[model samples]
Target: MPQKNPNPKHKSQNRAGLLRHLNTREVLAMLLKHGGLSRADLTRLTGISGPTITRTVQDLLDAKLVEEGEPSKALLGRPGKMIHLASSKAGVMALVIGQDACEISASGLDGKLQGNLDRFPMPRSYSEFLSLVSQKLKLAKPKNGVKLMGLGVSTPGLFNLLEHKISSCPSIPFLENQMLAKDLEANTGFETFLLQEMHALCLAESIFGESRNLSNFAVIDITHDFGLGVVSNGQQLQGHLGLAGNLGKLPIDKNGATLDAVATDDFFCKTIARLADSKIDIQGAINLFRGGAVDAMNEINLMIDHISTGVATVVNLFNPERIFIIGKLLDAHPDLFVNLLEATRRKSIKASFIGCTITRSKANSRLGAVSAVIGKLTTGKKFSLK
Candidate 1:
């Protein structure tokens, strides 16, 4: 008996099939970006063969992830049929958990919000919090054959993805050590994901906002607490245990005061109160700055100096294409970007400062979390669509 011969052509065919299957995700992502595309357009954009585009688009159509639109007129020969994501087929829920409140919203695959954002006060007890979330999930269920994809949560402090637990949340101590993702999954019978607020913001920016075309960038969230989210080579950096962007821990001064201590809204408010000899909160301080009070300006400059020091370190180390500053202060005072850029340039190297745009994040935490969930679905992650 002759020894069985392995055919090289058979192996090549198998490899080709696998590659086509993988290309399905790429096709879907492109459709999402461009809203719609013809087979020829897809072939040109993705560099895949015309036959492969037809096969991938057919597979997506079979899965109901995409749908066919009206054909386009052609100058010669047959017109082309357009393909686009089926936004009405499925929806995702986003929950943004803050210290005192939580925001929940539902969105479609096209990234358009399905309904109004629902705000709820956060309960102090972990059990109560879980109950509240469960109730909201029940209320957010899709109707008329629309599937519920999954839930994506954005919370403050350190989250350990491997353990599925929140390791630390200084503002909401009750959340520490809680298996939030697992709990949400178990309670709602749907896939759930949890991310640090800053990381979620960065992912949102990369997917739909200012950093969409950027492969490398840093998102600095300066709220009551300072946090950093670094994206390198188009991937969000999550260190061992998912604690990579804990910028609050970065020491800013010789006395070892961290960035969180020196560059937060709370810090600025307290500093203004002390310097101006008046009891004023963050909003009041913002008002004073807007009023052009010399004392308020001086305090803001001091805060910017510390913030610039931290940003300079990030620029020198990461060398990202952009640095996105996000917080109430930046939102209220758009002019701060000018001073921030000046201060950062003074502190950083000339090469580091060049081509690095610093801007404010337009998407709020709620929108960022929603975008994250939509991103997960587009990336072929597992989720419940029930």
Candidate 2:
């Protein structure tokens, strides 16, 4: 016997609702990228009907998701009122769990930070971390007319995507095997999402940094560890398990040493300290290099060689249009970043190398954390009518 179809009206309604949602999303995305637009402009850009665009704009205004602005005097003839995304009317709380300190910040939907970044010492235990977060949440009330929509955490480690739990965190071992996002959401009564630091950086670049509006790019993070974040065809390249950008583990030598194993921040610091016969931090090492310390310069050069190799691999494999490098190593000398770019070009395939622009990343981890939350709220079916 054939199975009976159910609810034809419901199916039709669902289809119509989906189309409406897509139209709303298209309008919002256009406004986000281009700032304000008249209903007529949105209709022309989105290829939607003028009546539908006006209706959608009214709906968004009524929902407080968008606001109308003064008519543009630049346009010829009768100017239409401009509609802008209500980025300031809603915001998200972002927490970045780092090796040295945990940073918390808030940002509007526009990806602009609302206030100064707050930093606290890294908690030694999971319970302590939660207690600190809870304390902060109590004081994190939204301003008048602004809604705190969600929480976003940018952390360093491998994650079990299926479980929404951290699988391993070398810097903060207490976080391993913990359902951090679930716990935070349950406690705070807000939706929560976790992103690895590299992925967060990717989102940051795509949303607010140099890669904005560009679909193909890569972010190489060399701050604490070597990692890569690839955005291809306008999507972050997370592997099946949500752990795709571990570029540090790429083997670059015949002796089986990984990129990260030999070229870590700790290794660089220790190597410089040993060479100088004095205990020194990364900044001090940079000072030594500036003072023409041969040994310090040599160590920096060696690390740059490894980093360039890693970058070349990314260029060859991903063919990203731009590659942004993030780390303090780039600040060691005025010529260091330039040297890395030149070295990467020499090692990469000539055709691929010519197409990719390599530059130092300017976005910070705090921005990355904020971008993660913004991305969570704006993308896919997660964004909804009020």
Candidate 3:
């Protein structure tokens, strides 16, 4: 038998590592953004040569990063085979650390639900949270072919990815400087990421939501929490320490009432209850606003003023193209959004009433638990922590 050449240049890449590389990354990004397409489509989109495209795609298929679903034949040339990421392989899991509890779920790059949103009691410590994340993955008992890529935690905090520590997480005490990313990664032997909650929402929205076209826009979420997502030049404004777009903490109601202090779900509940002389949860306050309770409307109008103050600050600073408000206030006061738009016009000197559109997120909130995983996978090297 002839001695075959064992080339050092052709070292094999494990299934996951190969897809995580450049050529397939280009292909993955194209398929993710433009939808399923044939090799010809990918070559055109990436500006790569046909031969390189063929070889790279073959690598993806062999590594199972991508798979062929169908062929498109125009009859004028060779049939084009539709290629897409092999989502069938182990799905990504995300763990959302909500204010109250935690939620874990699995989803695909298409943002489709793969598993039920599994709830875990809010852990007291960052360590506890890390433990539950692994516990849930174990409980899910993911079947083979669906290799677990890794996990991401959605929490209200600042992640200093540089330091690999959560610089600050007031909402979830003890998370400060916890080095969650490193800890989780070391313990689980899988890549782990920590992301700000609303930023994650923004990433999810930017990929598939009202903010799709507005690359330089911001998504200001007002729900149980108050946060903003800044998307700039087609990427998130994850400033130093992962604390970019934290508009909620900005001073608004100088009466010591910050945006989150006065505009969050807790604020609504407390203010509504105090004003109405009755306890009203977030939904009830929303209902009360919808029912057109005169007092509720009055309070809501005042609240919108504070909201406009917060938004004005953001507008003057970032000049975002859109400011999305995800809360009952939008459902109640169309005038508030109109008023904020007007305020934004007045506050920023050069800021000419940037076309601001405020509305609820088009993507499911439930994706919060799994959305980060999708983001990490699709974000490629520029943002990939692993």
Candidate 4:
């Protein structure tokens, strides 16, 4: 269905270009980590040759992916021009797909949002969702000269890296086994990558939240399901098929009840509804607890115990230096975070819990989306001039 290039010299040139692009990505990644660096710094940090660094930096400057900053004062010799990401030269788009809604936002390279977040109800089917996203992206295209780099999606589910599709998503059955990232890229013409929601939150934590400088930390998402994301030695621990954090079905108790069976937003919501003998949302249940309703308080305490079990398991297993829990149920009350912290410390191994700090996460999925785009553009894959 397609034509192939037969020219041997053309193939060699293309290979050379790809190698150069990869070297440029390595330079960009180094810049992203350190914020600003001189040409010598890049060469030293990346182990790239001085000439390659010079050529790569010039190409980046021409592409507007990087800009020259003030000259640095050299202690031993002449100063060098500092290179940094051009925050205003281009922007990236973030799409977070939750059970109830889909959030779309655009941010500059500096990770600052350019405009207000736009949200839409979750479409009923895959085709409908694709169409909606495509249409919305068309309307959200930048009118200014700022080029849009790519789109990053934060989704709640297990993504099959081997198959390049969503392998499992209980909340949205329509997403299972769907090639979501590839389809989005095909439809929207934006470089797209999909990550589990918790992974995104983990990235957000590392970039913008409390885990910024920590080399070992864990991010737990206790929403409709229980999920875990871990960072060790400054790298995400993605096991086979990037499914290392699939903790929903983990057997926590001897009774054979799964983690999600006892500790989940849906479980808490349903338990409170049954206790109150009425259909109520999670926030309403929190309000009931705040009002000193005896039944609500009991249910809340039990929910905390379940959450502590999950958190304690994470501590004992991963031995993370810090743990961040993100959930509406966890943030419902001022005392919940403190109570959970104390309870987790009690349940986990004393040595493992010694220095681990359990805290509530303030970072949302939006930052994760932004980090995803930056990661793809700089490190995930080789880029193209086209």
- Best-fitting candidate, measured by TM-score? 2
Better of 2 and 3 by lDDT: 2
Clashing pairs in 1: none
Worst 10 residues of 3 by lDDT: 377-386
The lDDT per prediction is 0.79, 0.79, 0.68, 0.82
* Model 3, position 294: C-alpha lDDT score: 35
After superposition on all CA atoms, what RMSD does each candidate show versus the true structure? Answer: 4.0, 3.5, 5.2, 5.6
Per-residue CA lDDT of model 4 for 161-271, tens digit only, reads: 777778888889999988887788888888876778888888878765777679999998887778899999988887787667867787766889887877887787787
Error of 1 at 155 (Å): 1.2
lDDT of 3 by residue, 165-248 (tens): 677777777778776666767776667766677777776676666665677777777775567777777777887656676777
**What's the TM-score of each model vs. the native?**
0.85, 0.88, 0.82, 0.79
Q: Cα deviation in Å at residue 294, candidate 4?
A: 6.8
Identify the runs in model 3 with alpha carbons over 4 angstroms from their true place.
1-21, 72-79, 210-215, 238-242, 274-280, 292-294, 333-336, 348-351, 355-359, 363-379, 382-386
Off by over 4 Å in 1: 1-17, 67-82, 254-256, 269-288, 292-295, 331-334, 381-386
Model 2 over residues 1-386: C-alpha lDDT tens digits? Answer: 99889789999999989988888888877876778898878988999999999888887777667778899765477898888877677777888899878888777766677877788899888988987886786477457778776777888988767666788888789999888877776777767767788888887887678888789999988877797889999877877877678888788789988888766666677777787888898788767767877456766788888888999999999999999988775776888888888888889999999998888888777777776656654555321101
The lDDT of model 3 is 0.68
- Which ranking of candidates, highest TM-score first? 2, 1, 3, 4
List clashing residue pairs in candidate 3: 89-146, 90-146, 90-147
Worst 10 residues of 2 by lDDT: 377-386
Give candidate 1's error at residue 65 in angstroms.
Answer: 2.2
- Candidate 1, RMSD to the unseen true structure: 4.0
Report the candidate with higher TM-score, 3 versus 4: 3
